[model samples]
Target: MGDHDINEDHAQASDAPPRAGDGPRTAQAKGAVSRWTRRVHKIYIICFHRGFAAFLVLPLVLALVFVAQKNHFGADQCKARESGCGFVGNEDAYGLGIRLGVYLQWLSVFLVVYLLPSEERSLMTSLITFSSALMMAILVLTFGGTCTYTVEIIVLLWTAFMTQALASITHTAQEIDDAGIREVPVISGLKRATTFQLNLDSPQGMHGFQSGSTLVEMCILGYAAWFWVCLLRGAEMVFAATPCGTSLFFFARIQDRKGIVVISALMTAVSLATLLFRLAAWIFRTSVKRWFSKRTYDMLGAVLVSIVYLPITLIAGITYLVPDTWMLKMFPGSGGREQLMVFLCAFVAFIVSVAGIELLLVWNGISDVYGVGSTGQLIPLTMGLVSLMPILWKLLRRYMAGEPLVPEPASNGSGLLIRGTALPHQGSPVEMAARQSDREALQLP
Candidate 1:
């Protein structure tokens, strides 16, 4: 009977389910495996994204360096009064190598753009690539070694500015899409205010240049106009100060004190004006929320911004009309004192502009209209760091800390957890109860 009972007990024990401890052990193993898997996945994603970005940017850098070197040599030749010193003047092996490199780099840009994933390749990216390639071709064919260093620098700066501005606009548009606020009434009104259409079928339209336009197109036109004016004015100032015999190699020697003054003053004025406009809009929006619709307030805000910005533009234009000497006289200083003043003005201007733009985007319902949060902060931060090192560094830090690259979806009070599963208690309830009893007993008198 004892032998039979022992056999039955053994069978029952063998057939029974796993111990309670085994479940936790299995879960721990799973958690560890998942953690490692996530780390590997993160590393792969970082490598992929950054590698692609670097590939896209490399051609532009190489092209700029090669073209600038070639142009510098050509400019040097021209300055020496050498015969046949023009864009096509250089046929030496070195010159040919530079030209070949430039051509290859330009081609590489197109190739890289083509290789981008379809989802990543947008109209703006195409346009930027095309424009950059066209500009490079023009510079190579027309200017060659004959172009002044100042002219070369200006062209490069203009290209970079245009690229950055278009990128910003594209990013903003994407944010708007992601926020799902494209159909917002205030946004629609703003779009309408900025956009214009011309009817070619109408008799009056035949005489006038008319076509459909978008907010992006309008912003482009405005940027182009502003940049051209600033470039021309700044160029005039630089040329006037720079001597004819100034070496092309020492391009920085070109006195741009006047240019600095004008830019600093203009930036300061515009930044202050933007801040004031933001404040006024906020006050108006708050005060009239009960009296007027949001769309109306937004439209009024747009009008107010335009009114404020227009005067600043006009004033800048009028200043450009005045002589540089006259402008300089307005800010009285000489030597180091003048330089210090210029530095202060520029510093102040930059600080104020950053602050103003940040407030305008965050507080003025701009981000709300676009359906973004603190991500909008990236617009200002990343715009200034075109090299993208900071962004990459941020990603690396986040990954190392085991934090997510993208922000978690904000809680909407739905009480539905999106991230981790519920974890079991570290100690069993019975063990906890025993510990509590011990502490209670120890405290008893």
Candidate 2:
């Protein structure tokens, strides 16, 4: 009986499931699987984040390439005819198509902004609207009466708007961090560096302003200023050379050396005046800390800058309205010196304009105060129609079947509505707590 009982015990022990870590091969397999899972997870996270940038960048890149090719062809034609080109003379269906793509891109941006949380949405909308308006004004002044270059102008406007929006977003993120939200150490450092580089505000404490790092930051910003000025000037030359218009006149009369030189000189003077005013304002704010509130200073700064730029705006309008003959008489020369002066003045104006606008936006909080306008509303309304088609079809089918217009909430097997419950709520209390802790640690909303 004892032997039989012992044999039954041994059989039962052999039939039971194997314990964890019982074999070398099993442990090795688990380790390998865990490593692969972590690698895949890392890869997925990178791709998911980078996908957003790719979506925005790829379309713009293609559009630029297409427009550039068209411009090249137009330039060749202009050379063959040995005449200037104007907007009315250079009508191309391809340019119109490029403009359509730009519109679609703006719609995409608007839709994405709509999907964001309320605070983020408001911030993004404000920045986008302000940037859009500012860019539009700049483009109109730069390429007034040159409707043939509309494709280039549209592309540039979108690019500038995105640049401002993204920069503002970064600045806002840093503010959020300072308000208690935390980020990864490396990421936080990078954000701080970027904010410092872009913002005109002096950092707090003597150490911050006096540190060697401050000099490095200034140098970097200077390099950025140089780069942008070169880019804008290059684009200006390219657009001027490209064919357009009815009797083949240069867009913006850019080929008219004297006119271009005068315009550039005026722009440069206005830009410098604005910069000087900004500097004075900055000094006042720093020296007389209690003179006026920060908001008051910002408001006054914006008003003063606008006033400083008003003369240039008026001159540009007059130039646009006046006949070509009168303008030629007013500024009559086609010398190499005039061309050189135009290039030099343009470079300086571009640099100052970039700096002044950035400082104005950051200091005045214009982007924060502005809200989305008619243009913003039109974008989503136009784009959302396509997205609504599937839902509309579903509703129609439901109506035909005599069902309720609004569907009921879906429930899981556990009899709980799934609509509002987060995934963590489905787990045990301990698991939920652990997940909550993890989220808090990561500073997730």
Clashes of 1: 1
Model 1: CA > 4 A from native? 1-50, 56-130, 133-135, 138-143, 171-445
The sequence of per-residue lDDT tens digits that candidate 1 reaches over residues 1-445 is 1234323422432323445767877765565444433333332222221222222333444453345334434334444532222122222211223222222332222222212111122433433443444344434533354433333333233333334333322222223221221112222223433542232233222111111112222222333333334344543321111123211211122224555545435544553343334334434533554687857854664466457656534443443454546545553221222223323443444344334323322221221222213343333223323323333454465456554433221111111111212222235575345323322221211
Tell me each candidate's TM-score: 0.22, 0.26
Tens digits of lDDT, candidate 2, 104-128:
4333332222121112323333344
How many residue pairs collide in each prediction?
A: 1, 12
Model 1 lDDT at residue 433: 52
For candidate 1, which ten residues in a row score worst on lDDT? 409-418
lDDT of each: 0.33, 0.33
